[model samples]
Target: MHRLIRRPKSVERDLDILSSIDTKGLISRRELMRRSALFGAAATLSTFGGVLSAAGQEGGGKVTVGLDSGAFTPILKTFAPEFKAATGIEVEFASYPLGNMYDQNLLALRQGTARFDVFDFWPNFVGDFGPFLTPLEEVGTLDELNFNDIAKPFQQLNIYENKIVGVMIDGDMFINTYRTDLFENAEEQAAFKGKYGYDLAPPKGYKEYRDTAEFFTRPDQNIYGLVEVTSFFVYAFFINQLVQLGSEKGVRYGELFDAEMKPQLVNEIGEEALRRYAELTAFMPKDLAQAMPWDVGRQIFFDGRVAQANWWTDMPKGAADPKISKVAGKIKCARSFGDVTVLPYGRAVGIAGNSKNKEGAFKAIAWMQQSAQANRWVAETFEQSLMDPWRNSMFDDPKSTFPLQSESGFADNFASVSKELLASPKAYLDISIPGTNRYLASIMQHVPRAVTGQATPKEALEAMTAEFEETTETYGRDRQIAHYEEYRQRMIKQGYWS
Candidate 1:
């Protein structure tokens, strides 16, 4: 037998009035906070109360969330209590390693275990887990979730088969981070122009990027020209170059696959992209073949040992932090080399299809992704949270901009470059069809072989192409074709392509 606890009548009345005031926009968030504090409602009410009421789950309950271990673990834990206060709901998290998170979540969802009410995962995983996830629209209205405030590129990421399946939580794209001190030095600039017959600045094309990388390689001084993730996830780097190459040639869908669902990676463009990617190894760390993005690649840049690195959006925040970075105040950001940039590994949150409390779960997700919360997360230093700005409001909000502004122009440069990248017609979406992980794994396997000289670029891509076909066929070629076509259509609709 269980005992039921209830809120006092006065506390319940205060919460109702607070919820009404918030819903009607009678006060600003700060003012609401002030009023709640004055009424002593801060101990029992949170801003989430309105969202819970909107979801028709204003009563108390508990929902379990599934999350991968990392920066998000601490953030969610810190906010859980606030959520509980607002709606009288408890948030229990089941954390898993990043690598196994997909498998674990998939297993539980498919098993109908109701193990998790919400799942926080990479946007691409929506393809594999769509069947087991609840459509967000069913739980709350778009306005209630503040859906339109999210970035355009990430908006498409949260949809599956024309239905809203998730809420964008982390905005991610590969951007170039370089040593400002090196690039601004007059001697280096003149020497670069004399040698390369072009101005010394951030690279505008692949050839220029290669030239820049080669020109900056000074191993004796412990400074390398370039570094990027080159390990198991090297596929992301390869795809970035591949998409840029395809966009340059004005090919649709970045030439990843054809209308017939045949992979295009065995062609001349594929070989060239692979070769160009492998060529950069000469100017990178000798152990580049096995380097992971976060551990080896980012650490090298933060240590001021790399002249330039193309990494995730969070790189600038880390670079600006004096506590963990040797390059603080000396770093500058630019869009990755190309007419197009690749958006990769962004995370989103979705309610589980098997959840007993879908409304409660969505309320939790909405609360986390609300503009104020997202802005706060973006305002925090990278060491505090890995979340990047995913909402338009976050970009313009003073709270979010002030911290980055104080970092000596990092905020302005990052915000400008990020807005351009996220809104560009040349922005390429990562493949998010079913079996996306497997297809990318195939690239991960062979790209390293070429980088290590175990195989030629052409040979490595040929093998990867074959494996891609097998993966597509294994999942049923016709079915995969439809999924890819649907995904392409969404990308085009979202202005990612023509």
Candidate 2:
């Protein structure tokens, strides 16, 4: 049965002081860590039954969640009955289209409507949604929420201004997937080495990646070098390359913006990233200019028409599914090329501040994420769910299963590569300050110009930079600067390079 495990009164007071000191910028990072550790210990030693009784005693109630239409929605619907049976809290969803999810959720919160007790949102929306959501720490202690179980990169996504703002429900980092049959073929390897002057293997850098793509392209055979999402959400793909390029060039903070909030993409590094991006299109499908990751990208890869694909973790799992993929056992996974990999999109669950049933909402979130059995079920049902591994236990535990673990040759390999990628020292977090969606939308608008030859890479990046500058000014430069500083500092503390 679900139980509300509240922090002790003394620990709560200490947390308030800690939060205040952190907010006022009066505490050093090291000291903050020390105090946080002590507080964690104190809370763990405290009681878990003082605030509320067991779910059986609390009686039946309802908790409505705000969600977008996606793979996650169906999973939640499937598991709702289980949660209700166990906790007596009926799970209901207020579904919205993905395109308008942010607006609908924000409108409800801004109006203090209490329309949803819980929200399933993109983690990048933390800055905009933070004030309207209750910190999970207040709903439950770190121990109760199993905070330490989450991966380091995703752990940082849950925190905003030192408060635990949400819990990561999906681990959506970009990974490189390729056809092992192509790479391992004796004739193909020999031919590649003879022509490129090096042994053929999975690419480790941009130069090798480009050469590999060019070598594999054979239009007459219906084979191409690569496939990637290039429409609508294309900005994410662009950022993936841009961040790695910046990391390789030793650009500061991975080169999205400077300390003063100036755009960094109007420079040489940005141009080169876009140029390489555009060049790759030559090795992709003819219709790639309008491809989306969910359909075209996956369809092309699954049809075994492409040798390589850089996509979210879902690609490897989907590739292994024989029902939808002709390349089932021929796939392999690795970190995206370069010194660092970018985390593009992921979902997080949070309780609404205006909810009358905050306790029930936290129970639902905890049930889905903190419960070991439930979490494993979600992660393993990859074909039916988009949830990827975000917890250490999911990978470290021998008994934990992945999609088609016994049947798919690459299941273990994908898990291993995912663990390595998430823990990589050079992994870059996405820009998640206020107006992050708008900032990314600007890139989406300008990227097509470069990809379609309507504008040069420099011209496109210059246009994007101008839009970024205008957005910063529109959002109030000083306010955005403060938000970025706090966001960057948090990322630094989490081991991401500046």
Candidate 3:
């Protein structure tokens, strides 16, 4: 049978390994075998008592999931057998690479082939996927699941046009984490105060953040201030930084667009955000543009080469792993240094509108969020896991932390990460109207252009605006405007924007 997930020809179903491709595109044999061993070691039987499984499931030969290749995939492998034993439902995953998953899922779901029962998606693309997904609330058996426990910002993403279409799977947002060893050093503190007129600490706002980054730069020592992944989620670095420019007064769409759906890319805030976004690359490796954004960036910090790295809860979590990080106990998680910290992109898995088995699919999605399950994934002894702590309760487990980190206690050390999550009183949802892919695509293609100084920030924004307008026109101007208006109003109602 043909498979949707692209994998090695020699790799087989029974092999039991977690795999990854390097930047050069060669597969490492040792890493694959290592992860496979961990997969066997980490999983536990579900004590969900039938609530997570399909006690009332319909015909269940196999239930397919349109999944992305991420840390979460391996976690699912651990539980798949338990789910099968409980519900008699075999799990088949039709997977794709991270960036490619959205387009492939769209292709699979749009056909009448019943290709996927459920698909993983980001909030930013809800508009495109909205039509293809079933309102999860409409699925009767899922009613008892506590919908309110999810973070409000995430709640904003899953509810589109007032219908709950997806389950909150990833609380992927930006949070600045810094080297406490640097910040707490008396000599560095005196030097920072002497140079910048302030005590060295985690920054509370934008200017301080830039200054803090600048203060830590020491290229002669091979130490730089900050590094952000340039290749994939660079767009997030763009959005979150720009959003902070207007965050204090509660800007509606941040720099996404004005109330009129006009692109706001050429403004003062836009230029500064772009400049600051590019400015950090100065202290990074010459190949900063090629650096892996999330997990691997942790290594750059642990090596003591950089003072700060920020994005996603996963970074701080993974940084605490003793086996991998030399600076494991030295990092501290904190709030965005500026105003807004909104959803630039996040994962929210949902049942396909065209799925032949909506009930079984909902069960699987719900299963992942069960309190016990959520904690296991977040606190999984392995340093790198598929998902982050999306639920508030994930942090409630006081004892769930690295073995070496028990000295400070998990609660005290983790306060910063959790506080960062709730710090943003307001955040903008990614524009989720039709042609969202086109809308974002227009903007993303210019990220490296403007940041690398190849294009003036103005030129980049103008180029993006042109593309945005073309996409808007192609999607029908008036219809999209109405949709945009509806979206803004909904965000206001949901308190995403004041």
TM-score of each: 0.87, 0.86, 0.84
Provide the overall lDDT of each model, using Cα atoms, as 2-decimal numbers. 0.78, 0.76, 0.68
Clashing pairs in 2: 253-498
Candidate ordering by TM-score (highest first): 1, 2, 3
Candidate 3 local lDDT, 220-318, one digit each (tens): 887778777776666777777777776753555464656667777787777777877777676676666444465556678767788887666666666
- In model 3, which residue pairs have backbone atoms overlapping below 3 Å? 71-386, 72-386
Model 2, span 1-498: residue lDDT tens: 999999898877756654443222222446444535532423212211111223334445799988788757777775565466446677887788888878988888887568899988888787788888899988887786787888888887856666888888877888899999999999999999999999998898998899999999999999999887778878878887788787777765365888899988877888888888888888987866445445778888989999988888778767877788899888888777886867887888898888999999888787676545444454445556777777887766423446355445465787788788877887777777888878988899888789888899999988988889998998899989988998778767766774
lDDT per residue as tens, model 1, 55-153: 334545789988888857777776665566555577888888988877888888887568899988888787888888899888888887898898877
Model 3 misses residue 214 by how many Å?
1.1
TM-score of 1: 0.87
After superposition, the stretches of candidate 1 with alpha carbons farther than 4 Å from their true spots are 1-59, 289-293, 398-407
Q: Backbone clash tally for model 3?
A: 2
